[model samples]
Target chain A: MVKVTCPICGGKLDIPEDSLPGELFEHEDCGAHLELVINEGRFELKLAEEIAEDWGQ
Target chain B: MRIGLAYDLIRWEEKALAYTIKDLGHTLELIHVPESVFYLTEPTIRGLDVTFERCVSFYRALASSLTLEAQGVFVVNTFDVIRNCGDKMLTTAVLAKKGVPVPRTMIAFDKVRALEAAKTIGYPVVVKPIYGSWGRMIAKADDESSLLDILDFRENMPSPHFQIHYIQEFIRKPGRDIRAYYLWGEVPVAIYRVSRNWKTNTALGARAEPANLDESTKELVIKAGEAMGSGVLGVDLMEDEDGRIVVSEVNAVVEFKNTVRVTGYDLPRKIVSSTVEALKA
Candidate 1:
């Protein structure tokens, strides 16, 4: 399992080993939605942005 | 509980679904559609009770839904529903057969017959691709000259589908159209996409205003959804000069950002709740 920290609340997350980058996860303790990412092989989490239908016509 | 999201690109709607799943005490998996390979047999995508189909491309959405369903994964806006709502020709046929009021439409495969069909429908008819959305490639032939010019462009197009002339009578509405987000055939919210232009798609910068449908209109919307199989969808309708509301189109993969904004309703919550309920059944 990949261990990461939620940027929104500093809560630790045990991300799945199979989880890919750009995968979204929610913090159990802080209840914050975050994206599981990697920078230089280091796990990173960023608060997810709100969904928008920018492509809607 | 776990929910899988089959998506091509990340959009606000996807994020909302993920957030809602999490808030509801479930895990959300973002299974990127372009990267996930569909297996003809056995299992490929696993670890989910159900999946929310959110691919922007109609072809991808339909194919992915079929593959997921094959693996016993419940997909919102199921494969059959996607196909029925995504194709204009099939959708119109269903609506007409169901006695759901829709614009008078005719299709022809050749340029000569296309002109003839347009004349029969009278001038100022709409020429649209059999498969498309967002008001793209839709032309209004106001007269014989405009119809010929539009057909000239369509005839020379390389895509064979474009060569097929899908003609429909353009209902003269009062500078706006109705767009309602139906969660399993229930219209929780509706909005008016007001545009001075003939095309009132919100993608073209149409202003949104909260609206409500009358009793009859609600029945028509439900019938349209039933014709395509039930799931979360966007149903489009228009009011003619005589105040008759007619079903224009049904979007299987609908965008509800504007509806949420103007109506002040928690659409994501409602959608997630509906999804959870469907999964249980």
Candidate 2:
């Protein structure tokens, strides 16, 4: 498991090692949606942008 | 009532929709379209009163909705409605055919013709792809020189769509544009996306505020929605320099995340209810 910290609320969370780079999951303590990205085998979390219904143009 | 949600990702709209579906005392079926496959014979997916086409991909959304409807499922935005509104050209044609006002537009196939069409429409015209969202690939050609440059860039582009030119008169308006949510021709919520940029898409950092829609604007929005036979749609309107409301675009699979935020209206509840109302008949 990868230990991740929420950037918004500073909450600690664990992400599975096998999770894909673009996998989106919610923070346990704050419920903020975060995307897991792997950079050179290191885990980085990014706050996922909310998509509007007709997002792409 | 049993409802099926066909989607690619669970955005805030979907989450709220699920909650509203449950709260409305209906069974929710999350049918992730990306993982699901269609069969020619006896697909076996049943018990759905109405399946909402919430997929992000326009092609996939239309195809899946049509496939599911073929297999005895009713999609919220029917194939006919989605098809009409999905294409920018078709939307404009329908609106114009229905006597609803739209910006003057011209379509051309090559650079020379595109330039000719631009000259006819005058300079600083808005150029956009036939099928797109978020104001991406939408630009303005200030003059013959810049228009040629813009067309030249698209000339070398790989996509065949770029080969076709969609040029329209740029409506100089107040620094804001209106995006209204319509369910079966009813305006549930409307918001003004305020931005200094000419392209005022909420996704492009436009500040969303509640819109004060006039009676005529609301009526025109309904007409625009009905023209495309859309049960759920996003009607984008902008006032010209003369304050005339010109229908800009109509989105079939409408998104209301920003609309909900600005108005605090029960976006999903209205969607679910409007869908139910549409199915009634």
Candidate 3:
């Protein structure tokens, strides 16, 4: 039940625990995707698209 | 009254500190940072005793001499805040976590992963050095190849680099960004930074203009500063397409050239007075 938000529209997002550390979580409200990573002992988010096909699958 | 000013040879901060000390009738101890330690390693306190051994070699010498327990000395901004603000990746992550609006950003450890991440972030994304300032090494990429070319050059360099996760919004005011200067949670002045280049930094030949401190902008700046737990700050902000404001970054020990010139406010006096009051309490 991790709380996330849209990088573009600032809407609330729900991130499933199974999502990989470097996966992208898209916001339903504004279609904004964020890059998720673990930094400084907590889950951090970044806005990134996938380079290869094996991203956020 | 002798006060020690510690910073690298950045003209803005240097001038601000000099003016403040001189006007306040205090002797200034100018600590000239040599080329070797211009980029000090970010500080982290591991279980007390304040170890700086992990910092660069040159800082080891300076760290040992610093009196962390000095009485009657007012640190312009504490070392802790400076360390946090120095890392862009860390700073944005903290602000975003606290529900502050920050542009979308990302960081990857290696080039392979970074390439994958960059593609996911999409085109027209900005790539910035994780530990850089004054708009140095900031690049915009429209595709994977361009990003790779930039990354290849950066990887070959001696310093480390990180990718900026894209923020899907136009610069509300092109070649312009807002900087709000705060003293102890109060904004004394707000300045708009304008430049023809994408990076609107005063250091990069940008022009400075006085900005009206609207209530919402002021609130956002204050919230961003408080999120980072910074006392004296220069907060960078921009508006999105939907007219929503998001914080770009926060600098702990802010440079005050354009701020002073635009607002016609004495930033040094405000900083010194606020610092001294904080120390007294």
Candidate 4:
């Protein structure tokens, strides 16, 4: 498991080891949607982009 | 076969699709849209049997698929399908030409003519922008004043696309609509997006329930797909007061998250497997 900190709630999140860079996850503690971003083998979490006007099925 | 998933933001559908591709023992390439740059003329993207366009934004999906397709990479739903489905006017026109049942629709370049068309179509008309999704900017005008009020807002919009009005007769549906997943020539699964609200889009907080497809509905779904060039489409249909089904919209980059939750079907796997299998044929 990959451990990361939730930027919104300062809570730790257990992410799957196989999670990709662009994968999105929601923080259970604060309900903040996050994006898992990896660079130089280091993992960081950032708030996911808000739904765009043109977003839908 | 090598596969690429070009995405703006990876949602549940994207992750499930990627896992399905990997689990099936195919090479998976994740093309993150925001960080990646596409060379239009030079063409750096290559070597993928098929690339799934999963971008949330219709414009982003269209541009990304166009770039990859230019490099001879086969894209699901194709550029033409995306372009056609992205615009409400094009979707309605294409479906109507294919003999598919569609709501009575009219187009006007200006707000005054739009109000005029709406008046002709009668009250309780739906005014939609040429380009939008998730029921954004879709409004119902119960009468001329309401329609004029709606048109007044649309006329002042800076974007020319929003300036053009596409009006349709409001079909009084049964508090829900059918959302069918059309893959290639067949509809593997479908669900009813149920809500008290007139707009039954799941993105607008509708509840999804598994819908058994009848023969007539299935045929309509397939026809809609064929009309849109047949590649992964979300064919939405509504039952009018007269009990006739009409094609409400066809979506190119369809989301299956809710359908999976309600139906317990591995839609991502089905979509991936069928797409890759077709390429091998």
Best by DockQ: 4
Give the Cα lDDT of each candidate.
Answer: 0.83, 0.83, 0.62, 0.90
lDDT of 1 by residue, B1-281 (tens): 88888886555677677778889888888777766788969886677788888887777888999999999888988988888888888989988998889999999988789888988899799998878788888999999889889889988987788877899999999999998777776878889999999999887789999998888787877887777777898889999999888899999878887888889998988988987886667
Candidate 4 per-residue lDDT, tens place, B1-281, comes to 89999997877888899989999999999898877898889868767889999888888989998999988899997999999999899999999999999999999987678878988898789999888788888999999888888888887888888777899999999999999999888898999999999999887899999999999899999999999998889999999889999999999988888999999988998899889777877
User: Which clashing pairs does model 4 show?
Assistant: none
Q: What C-alpha lDDT does candidate 3 achieve relative to the native structure?
A: 0.62
Task: Name model 4 segments beyond 4 Å from true.
Answer: A6-12, A28-31
Across B79-198, the per-residue lDDT of candidate 3 in tens digits comes to: 556556666777888898999898767676666877777666667677776665677667777777887888777777764333333223234455688888866778878888888787
On lDDT, the leading prediction is: 4
Model 1 residue B17 CA deviation (Å) reads 1.3
* DockQ metric for all predictions: 0.09, 0.17, 0.01, 0.69
Clashes of each: 2, 5, 11, 0
Fnat for each model: 0.07, 0.19, 0.00, 0.76
lDDT string, candidate 2, B1-281, tens digits: 89988876666777778779989999988776756797647767878899888877777788888898888998878888887777888888889999999999999999889888988999889998887788888899899898888888888988787888999999997999999887876897899999999999987899999987888899999989888886888899998889889999988777888888878898889999878877885
